[model samples]
Target: MNRNTFVPVNEPLLKGNEEKYLLECIRTGWISSEGPFIKQFEEQLAARVGRKYGVAVSNGSVALDASVAALGIGAGDEVILPAFTIISCAAAIVRSGAVPVVVDCDPVTWNMDVAQVEARITPRTKAIMVVHIFGLPVDMKPMLALAHRYGLKVIEDAAEMHGQTYAGKPCGSFGDISTFSFYPNKHITTGEGGMIMTDDPALAEKCRSLRNLCFKPEQRFVHDELGWNFRMTNMQAALGVAQLEQLDKFVQIKRRMGARYTSLLAGIPGIQLPLPRTDFADNIYWVYGLVLADSVPFDAKEAMTRLAKLGIGTRPYFWPMHEQPVFRKMGLFAGESYPVAERIARRGFYVPSGLALTDGQMEQVAEAMRKVFQ
Candidate 1:
């Protein structure tokens, strides 16, 4: 165990104008949700994402909820999602009053298996929420074809995949609507914020109006419909503007780090490194994930314990949504088994792959891993 070095799973990289943006926000006195920074951030992000409109919100979950709500999805409708992602994806669907249909993930990409998604669609299926897990872009061609055939909308949960591309198109631009999280651990940080991107002007307007309490343009106090206050502060938008300016550079660093880890751990036994997909031109490796082989002497928990003792932090993949207690009580996914998601959850462990991590630090973590698996 290295007492001097404690490698965390992820850390935010705040450099190159973050402080300046904060200072600018403070000086301008537009720290609230309404200001020039928010507008600027939305426009810049829209352009960067190749979308016609971008709606800034309080957080990723809220952005997702807004997008779903904007689509008019509610009770009697179903949204298909993979069981191997953050709970927020399911939460957003539930909040929008839609039934969440949990599907299996592709073992290779750890993303929604397009084949499984097609199998789960029903007459009530209104949308599909595809998460770009671990910054790897999901194969959208088949998913898009399925959606088109079924007349289902697609909402991309691109929280972890900033600056990632599928073929030549950006990940966030593939679906009908895409949501991003600017949380500290994500590729970019705005302290706590989110953005929704869409090419549909009507959907974009609905998102913007829903975020601002569904206020009508003709009246100040009159509300057209029920809505939540999911607005982002100008301060956060300022940070986001600065963060966006350096997103490409940050993604490049992440790619290099991922490649280095892959090279260093290539021949190591009992470890399955994430494979890059040619369909996706770039992968902004948010966390360098490794799946423990079933033949390994230890389970993912045991490996995590050993790594923690070695001062190396690790995180397990998301537990299958069907197995969660909340969803269990809801009885939405009874007797359903997503074998791939369950296996990944039990065997996957991702170590520190933050932007702040140095090559030597990664080497040290890899050494510790080698010691554990040996």
Candidate 2:
């Protein structure tokens, strides 16, 4: 093995019509938010996800913020979410003047424990924020049932789940308002962008209004409500349009990468690989993660340090929301403990699993892992 060969944690593949669309944008001077690619990208993504409308936003985080506000969930409302997800989930709720009620995740899937959600629900619970963690979809059948029974809204965060499905239904199709991210590391990259999907025309309109500063169509300068300037630029949409065209191919490549890594790293001691498939959906290998066994002498930070010295890039798992200092200082999740989330946060980290990763690079990563654990 070449000790100097470096493998990054993720890299975007842009072999499609990205250049053509971007050049078109430049040629036509449709470079701002008013470009044609914006609508084209939004409509195409909405159709692919089985939704009636899509609102392109600046990025995924604001997409959540817009979705929360559009749903009319504000002060005194409670949104149930997982403790194992990114801070963006809780941040949106907190920013909206709503309380985020968190539930523990399943140890195996690392998705919100649907079983635990029911126990945490109170009279103020207004919505269930279902985030599809990693590549696996949260068991949505039961989640949908719970939402139906409780009369609570569902906000699906399918940020890492492009072209993935749950129980044969599209992931973005499950929630009343679903959101997606097009960050460079996602299955499809648009540099930095996001989309909000919904079947209700009214909700779709609200998302659009919210993203563009709540400007009235009839009177551009007049604003009746406060909203953020979260519109996705035409240049970003050009990338999205081209990238969306290659989604099916990208998904296939991701699954193959995951399969190859699993085959290569299969019996390595002291590490737990991702569950390849759930009952409802196969793992998309958004990023190939590994959790150290309890017997391992070191935690994920040390593991990452070792891998970095070996010229392999890795990233630690999300720190559980309850343990975050910002939340603690805000008097949230006081005295809470989620053992599974805590353990994973300390023990889990993902290796190189980019769309642009070659088979040879993956083999090198596997060799690096062998060296690290030996």
Q: What are the lDDT figures for the candidates, one per model?
A: 0.88, 0.94
Clashes of each: 0, 0
Where is model 2 poorest over a 10-residue stretch in terms of lDDT?
A: 1-10
Clashing pairs in 2: none
TM-score, structure 2 vs. true: 0.98
lDDT of 1 by residue, 1-374 (tens): 55568888877888779899889889988889978899999999999889999999999989988999999999889999989998888988887778999888888888888788888889999999988889678889989999999999999988988888888777799789999998888888888899999999999999999999988899977996998899999999989998899988998899999899988887889898987555656567888899998899778999999999888988888888888899889877888898999999999979898888899889989899888988
Provide TM-scores for the models: 0.97, 0.98
Which 10 successive residues of model 1 have the least lDDT summed? 275-284
RMSD of every prediction: 1.4, 1.3
Model 2 spans with C-alpha error above 4 angstroms: 1-4
What lDDT score is found at residue 57 in candidate 1? 96
After TM-score superposition, the amount by which residue 362's alpha carbon in candidate 2 deviates from its true location, in angstroms, is: 0.8
What is the Å distance of residue 313 in model 2 from its true position?
A: 0.5
